[model samples]
Target: MSTRILISGASIAGPALAHWLGRYGFEVTVVELAPALRDGGQDVDFRGRTHLTVLERMGVLDELRALGTGGSPMTFVAADGRRMLHLPAEFAGGDVEVPRGELAQLLYRHSSARAEYVFGDSITALEETPSGVRVAFRYAAPREFDLVIGADGLHSNVRRLAFGPEERYVRHLGYYAATWRLPNDPGLPVGSVGLNVPGRLMSVGASHRDPGRAGAFALFASPELRYDRHDQAQQKALVRAAFAGLGWRVPQVLDSLDAAPELYFDSISRADVPAWSSGRIALVGDAACGATIGGMGTGTGVVAAYVLAGELARARGDHRAAFEGYERLLRGYAQGCQKGGDRTGPFLAPRTATGLRFRNAVLNRRWALDKMLELGKEVSSVELPHYEAELSGMAGREG
Candidate 1:
């Protein structure tokens, strides 16, 4: 019988894993807490050969490329709205950048026919049995699967249930980030424009497809604070408090916060899991090794999902071997990519005036900017095995 695999989270990683696992003849089920596919998120990019290779294997690279956001050039402005520093589009937008929402939807469309997706529900408990895993859900009937995998984000429900509390693995990087959509007033430029003060950054950029809309991406350095993730008002208050007296279109950005339909707010954090698996349960993507932002997290998650699903196929459903192989092959590469996130907050919004000036001065130099870009390419480089070829060979044997 084909292996029955349950994957938690329907974001990039979960759906990508499902696509491969289903292709390998595994019965896949994806569970997500969100009622539906999340729409409208910050643009994510894929750089280097490793990321491109995986997308090519999945057959979604071309589609994504067509939908790519050409790039997002950023202009840092002074309080009076004069350009202080300008960064080319390529600086933030790598080889190919696409809205995260579009990517997630594409993966879902590819896998939905073969994979059973349970939305508006989540895994509440997971019990390991000799033959399989007994699972409990928030809404669905209890069921059993050969294995369970957490493709959930940094604050993964599966991880909390199978591993432990979030505090154990998540480390805040002394900053907070928030993004929301607003009307793209004529005053806002085509690309992003921002005001950066010591420890704070307030930016707004036009939508690639819709000139009528804009996105606000801001960051501020701060110690970890206690707040409800679901409390929109509270999150807005925190943002307001952080940038209380900022100037240069920041007031306008803050004004839109109350009316913004959706808000994505979270601490700039990283997950460091000692082990990616235990017994019948395992983790992939951000749930395993992830940085909240600037960590090449989206690319790493895609690569990790591909590796994990491929290892399972290669192992022929022997999860113990598959899980170990997945972790062994990806642990080092994933951690290496995560190191970039450690510096994201400081690099984007330095804590002191001197630090901020130094960062801008250094980054403004052509050589220094080139070096940083080169480093990004180096960080994204990873060796990927040809899993599709192996899967095809196994199919041939079965045929």
Candidate 2:
């Protein structure tokens, strides 16, 4: 039987789920809110075990390695622009690092030919009946699908329609981040450099190959600030307002903010749902469990895609069984990732001068940093069980 599946969001998780679902004989359709593939953003990486296995299974690992940013180095600079300490290329970016937009493009190219993509459209309503799921799109007619999955990011429309409000599940980590491409490179001596003030951190780094342009991130902790997630002007204004007095090439970077075509600003937040599926609908990726920025968002998205599709195929598209198994296996890991993100927030944004100094001292220690990298590499790649073989093998062994 051909399982008709409607997937919302066309970035990492949506396309990846479509890829595996189609391979298992499911007819998939992906609808993206954006008019086209977003081709600009900061670098995201594949880290922490399960994520690496997904890339290998997708046959894109070598291609990704070829396209790697080549371990961009990062330096910590004083407010006056004096370099305090710089990390070697090895420490800044993990084993694999690529622009978020570039990676999205790669996933889109890999899945678009085999799947249906409706750009500039979104789901307005979703109704799950006994026969199937009745779906209504903002621009398309009402249709039905055997199952519906939301692979959207933190602010997922599908979650709103199927589940209750986002506020019930989302936990704000009390920080915000903004990224944009700088018109001119900051002319840094190495891969990337950051300047830290009392409550803000700004980074400037050229694309390893393309020195003409650079990426900048200005982030800080703020417990009380409200702005529309989709409002670009308002977000840009917020960034400007927050960093008005920050020094060290910030003025130059901020000067180009208005001109950059793909600037992004969002609060660091995570979502934790008791269950990812209800009735005939399921949520994947950030919609179900968002670890925000540091908890390996890219990795979690990719891994979730593989696991969700694999579980459905194994169960012959049985929503109840698949969702239950998925939750049991993935819930703890997702919680751990979210905790990692929370832990990293304090490290990334030290509240006091003493904390910042201590962080720098630890990072400056060559032996300590090397030891950390060695440990990190060891746990970053995890071997995933092949669903088909594992299921049958376990049955046979038990019998």
Candidate 3:
């Protein structure tokens, strides 16, 4: 009998996992909390061969390349709007860059035919039985599946229910980041333009699709503030307080906050779960290992999904063996990738003025900038197994 798998969160990781599970002939169902597929998030990039290979295997590489953002070059300016430093588009865009929303939509479209997706709902509880997992939803009737996986994200409900409270695994990385859209006003350039004042970075860039619309990206150093994630007004207020006295279009960006339709705000945090799975429930992607901004999280999540689903198929539905192999193969690579996230916030907005200046001075040099880019490529490197061979062999035997 085909293994019935229930996955939480229909974002990148969830749908990616569903695609592989369905290919392997497993019954897959994905539940997402959002009413619909989210739209308009920060541009995410896939760097190095490892990331590209996975996308190629999934048959989305060509499409993603076509949709890629040409690049988002950044120019850091002084208070008076004089450019102080510049970083090329390749520095941030990597090999392939696409708005997160577009990628999510693509993944959803790819997996929808095979995987049952329940949007506008979420898993409220999980109960593991000897044979399977019983899941309770916020709206839908309860159901049972052979296994459950959490691809939800950093603050995953599955992780919270299966493992423990969020605090036990989620670590605040001393910063907060927020993004929103505003009118591109004639002043903002085509690419990113920003001003940094010790501990805070406020920037605005033209939206890749719509030239008339601009996007705001900001980060500020903070120990960890208490706020409701659902409260957009409160989050905007916090952002305002952080950049209160800033200059160079910051006031205008702040003014747009009230009128902005949506905002993405959260503490720059990382999750380090000791074990990726317990019993019939498991965690993948951000729920297991995630870094908020700096972490090559998007690529890592996609890679992890492939491995987890492939391992499950290899194990022939023996979840104990599948889960163990998945962790053994991926734990090291995921952790190494997560290390980059630790430096993301500090690199974007240094906590001290001297630190900020040093970053700009060093990155201003071509050699230093090249070295940093090279290091990023190196971090993304991972040895992936050809799971297709194993699955094909299994099919041959069955035939």
Model 3 poorest ten-residue lDDT run: 373-382
Q: Kindly list the per-residue Cα lDDT of model 3 for residues 116-141, writing each as its tens digit.
A: 99989999999988778999999999
Candidates 1 and 2, the one with greater lDDT: 1
- Per-candidate TM equals 0.97, 0.93, 0.97
Ranked candidates (TM-score, high to low): 3, 1, 2
* Whole-model lDDT, model 1: 0.90
**What is the lDDT of every predicted structure here?**
0.90, 0.80, 0.90
- Model 2, runs deviating above 4 Å: 378-383, 388-399
The worst-scoring run of ten residues by lDDT in candidate 1 lies at: 373-382
Instruction: List residue ranges in candidate 1 displaced over 4 A.
Output: 394-399
Candidate 2: tens digits of C-alpha lDDT, residues 219-327: 8878957778778999899988888977778888888888888887888888888889998888998999896777777787788788888888878788788878777
- Enumerate clash totals for all models, in the order shown: 0, 2, 0
